[model samples]
Target chain A: MHEFSLCEGIIDAITAQTCQQGFSRVRRVWLEIGALANVELDALRFAFEVVREDTIAASAELDIITLPGRAWCLNCAQTIAVGELYDPCPLCGGYQWRLTGGNEMRIKELEVE
Target chain B: MCATCGCGETEPVIHPHDHAPDHAHPHQHDHAHDTRRISLEQDILAKNAGFAASNRRLFVEQGVLALNLVSSPGSGKTALLSRTVQILRDEFPVAVIGGDQQTANDAERIIAAGAPAVQINTGKGCHLDAHGIGHALERLALPKGGVLFIENVGNLVCPADFDLGEAAKVVILSVTEGEDKPLKYPNMFAAAKLMLLNKTDLLPHVEFDVDRCLDYARRVNRELDILQLSARTGEGMEPWLEWLRRGRHDALIQQINQLEADLAAARSRLIHGGGAIRRTVI
Candidate 1:
């Protein structure tokens, strides 16, 4: 799965931060994953655990925050909240929807020493 | 123990008594370390995105129209790329960065077709990330106004998530595959802007429903541009070639437009500052 590669990216980012922030051990990580980011939470957790082995975050706890998906409905002329990319507009039942939000995966904070 | 060389025969260093807590907790622990909270607020994919941005900048600087070609394992990507290179190599300089799990066969094929090519054998990587492509760019001498085709590892899933700094992701689907490939792999179809339905020459011999396939692809990406072609028989190659020409033309136009805007801004600044302002060509 791509989760392993994504976790590699996360670890690289964290390692880079450790150099600039002067931290040796990371105890916890808080991540914000959007609904439409196309990442499976369990898969990410598994990947993170495997990737963090023997690193600064070996015993770190992962905290995940999910964001909702938002899209623009062309027919309804309004912004609508969607749960998936292929969903139709809830207000007008139209498929002419454009994605607007909830397509992000970011690390928000870290507890380190 | 000495910090320099831990021989375990030195006096142990201890913290001052004042630094110790007054009382131990109900569930006491030996390690009493103070943790610090740091606010990062950074995208996890920032590293990849940074590489991608740099690749895009390099492409613009070189006026190279880069395209990432993706498809299943046997979707005729190499053939189409070879054919495209053979036909257009005389007109414009072209290069290729072929990705695969092993072997340099595709790169060799592209080279034989009369184009500069390099093979990136990803040991275990399913898709070509931006960082890999950036390294490949270092090895390739892509001329200005040339085309760089990056043939990704034959995967329709993982490549959908990675940004390779291409002008567009072109998915090539052959007639031998299922017509509902777009529906099955929606992410790939959704990410691609163009779908080349290759192997049209075999349409009569095979039971591939062209209309149904297009319908399924359109269902996922309504704005996708579809081109039917057969790299084997040179049928319907004009549209595909035209598409490449247009991409290069559009990139040139964009560069000209940016230079003109930069010039205008520089002129205004010079007019206001009595010729002391420096010109910025971004």
Candidate 2:
């Protein structure tokens, strides 16, 4: 599963960060998961918890922020928010809309003390 | 911090050196503490980026032209790669790393078409990553002038996020699938370097719009190389084959030169490490 591997990556990143900063404990972790990233936040969190034990981030709390899918219509020349990716530009009914933002899974920040 | 530990809890033992009287039992207060709000603006994948960059560096040093192919189930990725194996087998030394959920079908197809192929059954995994490819390469025994082709598992959305040490990333879409695929899944298209509109032989009977497919791909990736071809009929394969050959040749020559240099350096290193100048270059 992508979530399982992504959870492994998260654990690796968190481990490397804590080791580098000399922080033996991670208090909180913030992840910015885009709506279009196709990542199930719940599954990812569950995987993270299962794999993060015995690491500095074992006691960490996960905070996720969901970003809405967004795209820019070339004909309309304006960025618009849509429920799905290709919702035919709401302003001009143009199908040729370029995705500008959203659609990614990244950890926003980590709080260590 | 646990309410009782404070990083100094010792099995709730008496502090061996305590000379003062013990305090009364804990109070039964019911006051609720407010939630802690912390500000952190960091990306979770920020760490993987470093390893990805190193993988790219290794790819560049090895001078291998790696291409990661992504597509949906029954999208003809195997067919397209099998076609490439036949076309580029003699033109460019090539190898393939196949990813699938089960069985070595794709790898067998490429091997049957005459090329070195290694199957990576991700089992429950949805995509291929650089580390997996690196591990696969150790078993492939590829030499200089070798072109690496990685066929990711049949998934569009999950494979886009991974950078698998590839020189190019391709998204294969057959006309049998709906025309609204690119519109529906923008991330996969955006991540691809080119989009192969496979099975174009059925264009006449199907409701697929070649122009619409190209337009959608270009809309997402402004520089998307849109190639419309049918792996079955070999229709519209000339340009695709030519482009592939040119790319592989360019990368192979570089690899050959790098290997020669490495051999020379190793000889010189041996000479300087207390050995005579009896270096022989065959």
CA shift at B240, candidate 1, in angstroms?
0.9
Which residue segments of model 1 deviate by more than 4 Å?
Answer: A81-83, B1-32, B258-282
lDDT tens string, model 2, B1-282? 233112223221212223443444222224432223334354555544554565556666767677888999999888888987888888767888999989988889899999999999887788887766666776785534557888999988888888876778888999999887887777788778778889999988988877777777765567678888999999988888876777777776766777788999998888787555344432
What C-alpha lDDT values do all the predictions have? 0.85, 0.74
lDDT digits (tens) for residues B1-282 of candidate 1: 433223234222222234444443322334567677999899888877887887887787667889999999999999999999998998888999999999999999999999999999988888898978877776788757878999999998889888888899999999999998988887788889999999999999999999999987886677899999999998999999999999988877766776788799988878897564344432
TM-score of each: 0.84, 0.73
TM-score of chain B of 2: 0.74
lDDT of 2 by residue, A1-113 (tens): 57777877777666655333434467788888888776778888888888778766788888888888788877888998866654667898766677666776777777765
- Mind giving the per-residue lDDT tens digits that candidate 1 earns over A1-113? 78888888777777877645656689999999988786878999999999888777899999999989998888888999987655667998766877778878899999987
Candidate 2: which pairs clash?
A: A106-B44, A107-B42, A107-B43, A107-B44, A108-B42, A109-B42
Give candidate 1's root-mean-square deviation (CA, Å). 8.8
